[model samples]
Target: MDIHGRQLQSAKQHQVFVNFRGDELRFGFVSHLVEALQRHQINVFIDKLERIGEDLTNLFVRIEESTIALVIFSRRYTESRWCLDELVKINQLTDQGLLKVIPIFFKVEPVTVKQLRGAFGDQFRDREWEYRCDKPRTERWRDALASVSCKIGLTFEKKSNESEFVKIIVKEVKKMVQPQENYVVVPFPGIRRRRDTSSHGRQCQEEQVVLSRESAVLVQENSKIANQIAVVSMRYMDIESENSVIRAQLGELSERLQSLNSIIEVVEGVVGKVPEIPEFLMNPWQIMSTSSQPITASADMFYYP
Candidate 1:
C-alpha cells in the first residue's frame, strides 16, 4: 500500500466507528451523538445519508480500521440487511480482540434486541424468508445481536434528555479509546538479534564508529586553527600600522635636523662679519714668554718713531 493507503488503514485514523439503521436514528439521534463525539475531539466515521445509494465497500474498510464499534440498536436496526452485516463484522472483530463493541439500545430495550422480540423481532420477522435458504447467515446475525445486547451498554429513554444520553456514550467511548498519536509508525522488516552478528561484522561497525568520532574531532581542531590564524593576521595588521607611524616620526626628525643645520650656517656668517683676531693674540700667553713678542714690539716702535 502507498503512504495514504497505509495511513487510512491505521486503527488510529478513526478511533470510533458508528453503525446505525435508517434515517430515523441517523437524522435524529445519531447526528447528535456524532456532534457530541466531535465536540470531544473524538475521531469518528459515520455513514452518510447518501451512503444508501453509493458503494459501501469503503465503509467496511473504515470499520476494520477503527478501534471501537458503536452499534445503535434502534427500532429499525434489525430491518436493514446492511446493518446486520455490519453488526456481524463488528462481532467478528470483537471476537478477534481487534475491535471493542459499545451497543446503545436507543429507545429499544436490551431484552427486546437479545430475544429478537418486541420492536426488533417484528422488523426481522418481515424479512425472515429472505434468509430462509441462508440459515447460517441469519444465525450469524442473531448471534451478533445476542452478543452485543448482552454487553453492558447505555439505553436512551423515550422522553429523557438525549443530549445527556449521548454524553454518557461519548464518555464511555473516550474512556476506551487509546490516546491519539500525532505520528504514524511505518513498519520495518524483521531483523535478527545482536547475538546473530558475526565477529568480523561487529569489529567493522566498531571501527566505523571510531572513525566517525575522529572525523568530528578533526573538524573541531581545524576550526580552532582557523581562529588562531585570524588572530595572528589581526596582530600583523596592528604591527604594520605601528611601523607606518614610526616612519612618519623619522621623517619629521630629519626635517628638524635640516632646520638646525641652517641655523648653524647663519651664526657662522655673523661671526665672519666681525674683525679677524691675529693668530699671535690667539696664543698670547705663550707669545709673551718667547722672544718673538719682543722682536715684533721693537719693529713696531722703530716704525712708529
Candidate 2:
C-alpha cells in the first residue's frame, strides 16, 4: 500500500481528535493532556506527530473516525489554515450529529473567537490576502470558528495548577466520552495552585512543572517499553512450544517409516514385491492441522501391490 493508505490504516478510530497549534503546545499541555487521556484508556488523535508536509486530507479522515473532537483554541490557533480547516470539518460533522466537539479556551476567550477580535482573530485576519484568496474556504472557517466558540468549554486561566488542571480536563473528557456513573479527579491536598501573581513567580513555577511533567513522560515511556518486551518474550515462548511439538512429531514419523521399510525389505526377500506407501503416508504431519492433535500414520493409508 501507499504512504497515505498506510497512514490512514494506522490512524485507526480514536475516541478524541485534538486540534491545537503544534508549535505552541506540541510538548507542553498537549502532551500532558494526551498522557492523562491514555491513562484512562481513551484513545486520542494528535496530528502534529504524523503530519507530512501539508498532507491535510488525512486529518479530515481522522476527524470523521473520531467520536469526539477537542478544539484547543490557543492565541495563535486560528492563524494556521490547517487548524481552521479542521474546525470547519469538525463543525460539519457536529452539525450532522456524527461527531461531538469540545472547545478548549486556552488563554483565548470564546467571545473573541466568535467575534474575531483578539490575538487569535488578528493572526487569522492578518494572513496574506494571497493565502486567503479562496473566499468560500475563508467563509467556512469564519462560520466554524463563530459556531464552535459558542459551545460550553473549559477555560485555562493564569493561576490554575497545571497537573491538577490536566486531571480536571481529563475527567471532563472521560465523562463526555465514556459516560461512567462517577467521573472524578482526586485532588492533591498538599499541592497548592501555582501563584501567577507575578511574572517571576509564574515563570519559576512553570519551569518546575515542566521539568516534573517531562520526567513523568519519560517514566511512562520506559514502562511501556518494558511491557512490550514482556509481550515479545511471551510470543517467543509460544513459537518455541510449537517448534518442540513439530520436532517430536517428526521423530515419531521417522520411527514409523523405519518400521515400514523393514517390513517391505522382508516381503521383498520372500515374494520379490513390496507395498508402496504414498507420499502423504510417509509424511503424515504435512496434512496435520496446526492444532495440538497429532496425525498418526496407519497401514490403511497405503495399498499393497
Candidate 3:
C-alpha cells in the first residue's frame, strides 16, 4: 500500500533510500532528514530498522528498487565490507542508468570522498590485493564518488552536532523532492473508431460489435478489480497505522495504571490501622461514669416513701 491509497502495483514514484553503516551520527542525521522529507510529502525508505552486520547482498536487495540512493560518507564507513559493496552496487546502477546516487560527506573531507583516498584508499588497496584482480575497482569507486560530488555538493559537518547537519541535509533533500507533473499516457490513434467499425468482410458486423462490447466490459471489470485491490490495500495500511497508535497509547495507559496502583497501595497501608468511629459522638464509658450513682439513690428514696 502507498500514501496514495493505491496497491503499489508498480514502482513509478521517486523513492529515496538512505544507506549507511552503524555510525550513530550518520543514522541520526539521516533519520532526521527522513522526517523532514516526510514533512515535505516525499516518500523515503530506510535500509533497515535494526543494524545487520556485513550482509551486503541483503542490503542491496533492500535498496535495489529505490530510485535514489543517499550514501553517507564517513571515515569508518570505508572499513565495512557491506558499505563497500553497497557503494559498488550504487556505481553499477549508475552505469546501468537505473538510479541516481547522492553522496553526503559526514565529517569526512570532500577530497577523501572523491579520490577514495586516505583511509578509504588503504581499505581498497587491501581488498584489491585479497581479490588479486587484473583490474582495480578503485577507479570505478573514484568515478562514482566524483560524479556524485559534482552533481550534488558535498555536505560536510561535525559528527558531534549532527542536528544542524541534519537540518542542512533536509533542506537539500526538500529541493530534490519537489513535486512534478505525472507522465501522460497517450492512447493509440483510431482505437475507438476501430472498435466501432463493422466486420462485414469477415463476419457479421453485429457479432463484431458484440465482441467489442464484451471486450470493453472485460476491460472495465479488470479495471474495477484493480481499483478494489488498491482500496483494500489502503484500508489495510490505515488499520496498521491505527494499530500502531493504539499500541503506543496502551503502553502509556499501562504505565499510568501501574503508578495509580502503587499510590492506592500506599494509601491503604496508611489508613488500615485507624479505628472506625464517629468524630462528634462521646464514649460509653464517659456517660456511665457521670450518671450511675445518682440514678441508684433516686430509686431507693422512692421505695421508702
- Residue 256 in model 2: lDDT: 100
Please give the TM-score that candidate 2 achieves against the real structure.
0.53
Q: Which residue runs does candidate 1 get wrong by more than 4 Å?
A: 1-12, 49-53, 178-305
Q: For residues 190-295, what per-residue lDDT tens digits would candidate 2 score against the true structure?
A: 5445355588876766775676667656754664454355435534654887999999999999999999999989989998876678888888887665457876
> In candidate 3, which residue ranges exceed 4 Å CA deviation?
1-14, 24-27, 50-56, 133-143, 146-150, 159-161, 182-305
Q: Which stretches of candidate 2 lie over 4 Å from their true place?
A: 1-12, 49-54, 179-305
Candidate 3's TM-score: 0.47
Residue-level error in angstroms, candidate 2, position 85: 0.3
Candidate 2: worst-modelled 10 consecutive residues by lDDT: 180-189
What TM-score number comes out for model 1? Answer: 0.54
Estimate, for each residue in 1-305, the C-alpha lDDT of model 3 and write its tens digit.
23432322144354777767666544466667778778777777775643767554656655556677788877767666566667777766654445666788777776665555578657755765665663455444434445554445556756456667666766777655554233211233444323223355335445545676677567546644543554355346548879999999999999999999888788779987446575334465566656657644666676854
State in Å the error of residue 56, model 2: 2.5
The whole-model C-alpha lDDT of candidate 3 against the native structure comes to: 0.61
Q: All candidates' lDDT scores?
A: 0.75, 0.76, 0.61
Question: Compared with the true structure, what per-residue lDDT tens digits does model 1 show for residues 57-88?
Answer: 67777788888999999888888988998988
TM-score of each: 0.54, 0.53, 0.47
